[model samples]
Target chain A: MECYSELTCSLFVDGELTGDAARHLRDHLVTCQRCRDLVHALRAESRVLTESLRELPEEAPSPEAFSHLGFSWVWGDLAMMAAVLALGSTLFIWIDHLEIPGALEWFNPFSLNGLTNLMFNLSYYFAHGGTAMLTEYVAVVGGLFLVLLLGGSVLLLGRRWRLPKNGLGLLIVLLTFSLPGFALERRHEEFVTIAANQTVDDTLLAIGNTVRVEGVVNGDLLAFGRSVEVSGTVKGDLVSFAKRTVVSGSVEGRIYNFSQSLDLDGQLGHSIYGFTQSLRVADRGHVGDGIVAAAGDVSLEGEVKRSVDMLLSGNADLSGSIGRDMTVTGRGLTLTNTARVGGNLTARVRQLKGVHIADGAIIAGKRDVQVRVRKSQFARSRFYFRQALSFASAMLVGWLGLVLVPGFFRETTQAVGSGWRSLGLGIGILAGVPVAIVVVAITLVGIPIALMLFAAYLTAIYLAKIWVGAFLGWILLRPTGATRYDWLLGLLLGLLILTIVGFIPYLGGLVRFGIVCLGLGAFAWQLYHASRPAMTA
Target chain B: MIVEVEEGVVVEATSSEPSPLGAVIRMEERAQLRVAIAHLPENYRLPLVLRYYSELSYDEIAQQLGLRRNHVAVLILRAKQELRRKLAHRSK
Candidate 1:
């Protein structure tokens, strides 16, 4: 037989090998000294790696190892919580003082989907203190938010590293951007119009019934209206939230469109980030970057310098020159003869022919098409929103973790250092814990303990992803000096990817499961190794 | 791109063995590993640190670094070889 490839052997060591290959490798292992030696060396190095890291400065390490950030880090966290409380308390009190009834009608059971409706009504039934159900729901969700915030605070406080400069500003920006506002913004109610010859320099945040931008805007053009039209040139970004938006203008930057129906005939210097009901790019349009669109009906007859990624519940027709990749997931997809792709064309449609490609179409790269289950627009939107929420929350948690126990965070991630051993332990813990909880609960005497343990376990599982995000962040950002901000950037970038990946159909769930397993595995693996279970042995 | 160039430099600098032996192998503290890692080229260094230090699987490392799985293995192997040579040279 052929000598096992190093990649294969490496995968084998990482426990990423499968049935026949693994068996074959094992058989070869008995006969191959070189392969066995390689394996031995890998295992030995991994052990030494774990041991070497054990000498890292812990939050409370011995004198010789390294110094801890005991006081300053803790004080920084306390100071942050102080600020959050000072602001939050005022907001909470103000909200409570307000006599606004039906403002939270969106949270009402009837307004929610069937499942959430049922859950909300149940809470309403159990609001034993005669308080309004809406008030109670708000309070409960509010309490959960606090728990998440305080839990993050407590986690950060446990660490021993000072917060980065401008942490407060970063925190506010993260919180505000991630949390979608349900509160009333009456911008869409007014009838605003920018005349044909007008020129606006700054970004326009307008809300109106019928708004039209016909003049040049040096800054970003943002409008929320029933019928929004942009026929002018926007030197900056073009952001529109409307029922029907028609763009015939030129945008120097990106186009962010959140609309019911969109029609574009523009010269865009950047990409188009759109979430729409029906989207069409006119034949004259040109996109400098790529297109990331989630819409119902999409037809592109434009030019894109890079890739085109679309998650659609409706039909799609493409007639564009994609410089790189083209990934389309939808009910139906058509690659018109004009669609000439420089790279791969990956489509997950309802049927093989749900994606129709004309004979004139030239795909220079691979053409892969897989049929997929289509979800309701409502379901997909909700999923996207929840993912955004989860990503935001993880940022909060990771930020806290990085600040609190920077060393511990670093070490926990390094636990991934143990390779297959950590993965196996992670798998065992993730799969075994619930079973253990059930077994303990069967005795009834261990009920409270089991429940508490279960709660902590769940929290640990949630934080595992955050920890993984942090690890990813640290790896990506090269530290010029120990004084840094890369971890935060890494976390945001990594979690953003994780959240986006979690939106894919069948593959999304599988990817998330792998991440969870890896994270949980890394956490457990780190913990076990961190304890110096068999030091110097 | 710059990182890839660094890895090229490190690969050329490294000697025969993929890992160091003798006294240089005594990396007692994580700081020692950092010092050793500093010798590696930019590209291969992150992959090596991620694998040996972070305990990240080859696939995870690849995903994080945006490299192919097989490429990640090669990078790791090259990285280890370079690190071994650098540490040995340093010790001498």
Candidate 2:
């Protein structure tokens, strides 16, 4: 209807309009010079955006973003102070728990009640229970402290002080630390009977978290996970469904790996089978059998012992050698200088990026490598890596600033301490409540409350160690006269002490454990203190 | 001989067969027949196919999946047929 609308319609056909409203607005563009000009401007803007989109960096969230989100130094400083106080308190608790301890058999997380009962019974019969109790208290408290410190250090540093990040990181670290226990616990809880003498069926074994097969399979082997690495040999066809599938071993059988990323580095005795978003074949490896792969990005660096049939959704780099024949269908295919092929390469549709063959590089067969220029996946990875590096650097800078500025450090530490105290107390109560319920179910009397109190005692010891470790890390980072008269040297010296002393054998462990306990204690105190106000008010 | 697959026949195909596609169709036809006889659920198909080719027997797979004997056989056949056709189309 309008001249501008016609231009806008043309722009939309040329891939300008992203939303339905933009498409609908094309009607108004035809009648107005302003709208026509707007369409032209939008077209120019689109081109600019597309060109620049490839250059945008993928980075971690910058430390400045965190600061902007409001992680004040006051919180951190309080955390540091509370941690210091808790460490001292934990030492006293540790000594007290050990000295008054009866039988230490109940100190483990597994069978607390029965062990405690045994300990009390043994205390009445023999004085040996006191020694055992002391040993148990020391071991349990000490071990838990290590877990907490390791978890917290990873949390504080890995998250760069975001509450959600810290919590998630800590959970993962703790879960990783408790993996062996968790695995056993899962097995115990889920299964009633174990099938003995049942050899893992190769096919049944195909579906697993991690499967490494060495023999030939009579059928297709489906493998998948965060990482599925096949380095051994496979007899039958291999098919994987995963994020990443790496094949470094020989596959006598055909291989089909469907993943986000796939790698083939060994000889495929049969036809190579693969469909990945990104595919790579190593230089030393050979696909004796023909290959079929579909990828967003395909990189061929090695020898294709046979024919290669690939449909690249994005861009492909063909550099290595192919024996019989090669055919690539993609947005763009680049032939590198070192690439070699014995057979003709034919593509029904080919997009060429840049082909650079060296003087010495030989194409024994026909020059059938076709080309059509189109945008591809490499452009995207470049953009992402740049952003990631930028964010990481920014966060690093923020952390360095927090450590360097004394006032800032004090404030942040204080906030962290207050948070830890509240969190610890809440966790302690939550942990105790379950045990109390179970005890009451069994005893049907006042025994449940007593049992809960006992559970709280154990949990407190563990949490205390975590807080103390963190506190020790901060306090130990004092300005020592390492470099003569240099302020920078003093800062470096503090960091050095914090890292080094906190990792040493006996002394570090004790100090770290103490800090952790203190943090836990502070958290418990805060929770109780907070809850009391609501009850009273 | 080129045998056209009826709407529902399952075929089994191995690399050694004259045509991988033909064998796959056979596997599919057999699987379809089994599924009807056994009256099994749809979800059991993939695991059953994977188990069939591997060292697992019908009984073992049935036990693992918490299913009946006939259902496993049905699932395995159906899965075999589906995979063969999907893979054939994908390879092209």
Candidate 3:
């Protein structure tokens, strides 16, 4: 503690040290001039290095992102499904043997070879024995399932006690890892149930009026019934087509729900693709690849590993974790303070004011209105209020963008120096790109390519003003004669200027349009110049 | 370890060392550093790339690499040390 450690210095440089340690170090450095200087030097060094690294701009969208999600990804799940079936039949015969040592004992009934032969026969049945073996095993699995379900339901329902969610989730994760098979329940009248204690070896198809899965299904679960309740563990895809679907268990695969109302209070192994009148993914829910939810009032209180695409008529209340992009087409959207979206948010909301995006809701990606972008209703002087809000929002976004990837902003802003050239390039690109896209789309084969280019074009257009703002910020801050550019201040002043001027009438609109063209031109100029040498090389 | 060589060879190659905190954030420098990093051992490379380029936290890097969370920090520290050494060596 006498001398500040280099390890601490490194962590400090990375801004990782928090709370007491950071506080202590800062206090210590106050009296210790030498250490203060050292810390300063390290900060400077790391800042420069980080800035350079950021500029490397490695977060470029991968070409693979454009590729269609193909069937190749599900091949592993299918193979696992086949294996589960083989194991389930053996379990059935073993349980049957335990109950009655003589009844249905076709092999050498007392020996290990007898058990081995029984399993071998089950495998033969899985491969060639057909529907008979499947039907026979389902009866056994279904029987045990009912027994366990009834027992648990009686005890738990009687006590009015629910199992702890975390423990249940962990238990399901462990149980579902062991088996994979196809469980067939084609009863037209009976309410089919897969118990909590039961483990289905493979894919499950429960076709009944009301289906309840409370067991651990080792394979995919496909239930087509009036009401479906899944409280069990399905290690594969959970596909339900029912009037009301309630998933209160863990699914170690994608969930495809098509129902009137869908309630998810479980952990999803992969993504969710659902169409429902109303959907609620509860706080305890966790989805791996995000969700493609087309519902009425979708209330998401869960963690999504990727993005969320919501097509909803009613309100969307989101207070969860999103790993990437979130696109919403809804009447209203509300993001609680606890909500964190790691990537961009594009909302096509009917009214902007109804979309209550609270403080502490971290959206790492750009928050832009894709379609039907409207100014929120301001209680004060509507024109001035909107401008002020725009300035503040844009400034915050610009600062965060710079902090996240300084290189991108740095490069874009650099183009502003060649003012006329950049403006020319931007105009050319803005005009030419649409035509190119249209021509490409006509080919049909190049549709994806055209769409991708269009997306890029839109992004560039959106960012065009940002470059102009940054440039203006730079010029304003230049007189400070500081070596490094004060980009934050530049961005703020520029955004304020842009926003305030936008409050003007027809002239303001014309001015904004001119700025867009100029900004786009500059960006294109930079891109062209930047890529030329590399392309030639 | 190679300070003597750095003083004699690399010192002459560059006009002078930058101010402790005043290294210009240059694209060329990034390219040079990246090229230098490409020469590092595979074990060091992934952690460095993920830590800096990808901006992954220690826990995330650990999970992706299937290493213990604490181990990721250790790897990052070692990787930086090695990177600095290699950059100096390449400069020579």
Candidate 4:
């Protein structure tokens, strides 16, 4: 008799042979020794195959090898949240400083009667000022977000391509050299001077120990030096980064100054924006537009045709005329007798006693004095409302994360298994990044990199809580067979628990901090592993 | 054929008891099997490994390899046949 097919015997041994075929094979095996031996051989072969394959050492390195380090990928939703918060805060500060007519009254959270009122006010603002605001801020914010998203996607998805060690350096170099309008005149010397009679029709980029521009620069003047003295006419903008910047010449365009000391005795057709230790607008100096400065000390004796917005750490003394609104925030403010304001005068000081208005000081419009109050942030209902808003925003972000990168989201949550290691790494990263940022920023060449790092740092901090929440949710729901939208459910439950825990008076902060540390560490660990060359299976 | 049956019985007995000498022999056999599997063509080896090592079902292996379920079974069987032939030839 013909022996049963070996394929049937293999299938039978694998428990894949079923129904009548399996029954028939079993019945035949009772009588046929040859077929029985074939079946036995196949079973033995299967056992050997399984044992040999299972006993083979794993090709990939053990996860325990780098369990001490935590990893993280830049999450899109977190990035978006960071971007929106940054943009909103900047806009609020700008509007608050500019004291735009009626804008503050609408945004006053304390004045709102209830949630309905706040919502109504917000909707009203969106309806009325949305177009102007969106056009001004949204375009820039959207473009930046789009670029970030694209870059992040590439980094996350492009596993096949590896960036070389010096890739970022190469990119920076290429970008610097390949910028549009690369025909600008470059000057680097110990003491560079554009003599009085000379005329430069093109933009002048200068770096020196002391840069003196006494001649005409028909275009923008980009100056970097220990001391920058611009005594000549600059038809275009003047951007100066120096220890001491003195502008005694007429500049048709805006003046952007980053210096320790800025003395503006020159005529400025537009605004003067300065980040300086001390800013002085001399008696003869005049600004056609506004003066926006963040300085340690501000002495404004000149006339500003538009507005004067200043954030002073030390003191501000204004004796000159302001064409429109004048807003000053500082330790102390002084309005001299000769000080004249065409519009509103708003002073924000630590104490009302810090503001001094002379009897002869003229104000054409409203004079509002705001004294800073020190109180517990949690005491305010607005604080709770803000917290609720934050929770909702986080939920939205978490949902987006779950929808976009489910695999990564799950992996990141699972990575939190090494709790102590993640916490330790998180603590290191949280404390070390700022120090690294400062070091990088000190090298002016790395300013862009420093900014990028700062953004990433903020994004990571915001994302830490979400990661913890997701992990918590997973842990709680794992026994329930969390297979469908498990991450979303986990995130929701985890975030709710975290929020409740955070409301606990004294222990809440400590618990929250620990959670953040764990999340950060896990992310860092995952990020490190992700960046490594993947092991071939 | 009778000798092959006796060899099968010895293998089954050795695997169950695994004495020191039997363990050594089993290790050598496993090493030989690994080499034979590695030498098998990708078409057969992939399905076999996916079934035995990964512990994937035939349907899953078919889905992963984008082959029919029956095709996956056939490929696995062929892979085992090839491995057995290699091992037998080496022993000879």
For each candidate, what is the lDDT?
0.65, 0.49, 0.65, 0.73
Judged by DockQ relative to the true structure, which candidate is superior, 2 or 3?
3
A83, model 4: CA deviation in Å? 32
| Per-residue lDDT of candidate 2, residues A451-507 (tens digit) | 544576665554343333333344554435422223333333433444356567799
**Tens-digit lDDT track for model 3 on A1-537?**
486776676676566778998988888898898788777766554544454455544321221221221232245235434444444355446544433222123212334544555566688887886655543343333333323322332333322223246646744653454222212433333477877777777667665668898988876777766788888888888878678888888888898887888888888889889988998888998888888988899988988889899999898888988999989998888899999889998888877776899998989989986445455534447767666776676777677668785755676687677777776555555555664454333221234545666898887777777778878777876646522347777777776677668658898897687678778877655553333112110
lDDT, candidate 2, B1-92, per-residue tens: 32233212212223335776765674554433332322223354324322422324556656756778666555544553454455455448
| TM-score of every model versus the real structure | 0.38, 0.28, 0.32, 0.54
Q: Model 1 over residues A1-537: C-alpha lDDT tens digits?
A: 678776677667766688998999999989989998777666555555444544432212211121223343356447656766675566445433332123222222223342364466667778763445544454444333443343334344333123334655655664464232212122323566667787776666555667777887777766656778888887888777678888887788998887888887878899889999998888988888998999999988888889989999988888977889999888888889898898999988887767789999999999998886556754677767876787787888887877887756777765654557655555555655654453233221234445655896798788777766666666677555543267778778777777678769999898677667677777764553333211221
Which DockQ value does candidate 2 get?
A: 0.01
Reported per model, the fraction of native interface contacts reproduced equals 0.18, 0.00, 0.11, 0.33
Candidate 2's C-alpha runs over 4 A off are: A1-205, A214-219, A347-353, A369-537, B1-92
Q: In candidate 4, which residue ranges exceed 4 Å CA deviation?
A: A1-178, A181-192, A197-205, A413-458, A472-537, B1-92
Candidate 1 stretches with Cα past 4 Å from truth are A1-189, A209-211, A225-227, A241-244, A320-325, A337-339, A342-344, A360-366, A370-537, B1-92
Q: What does candidate 1's lDDT look like per residue over B49-87, in tens digits?
A: 566545678888788777898888888777767766776
Which docking band does candidate 3 fall into?
incorrect
Give the candidate number with the greatest lDDT: 4
DockQ of 3: 0.08
With candidate 2 superimposed using the best TM-score fit, by how many Å does residue A270's alpha carbon deviate from the native?
A: 1.4
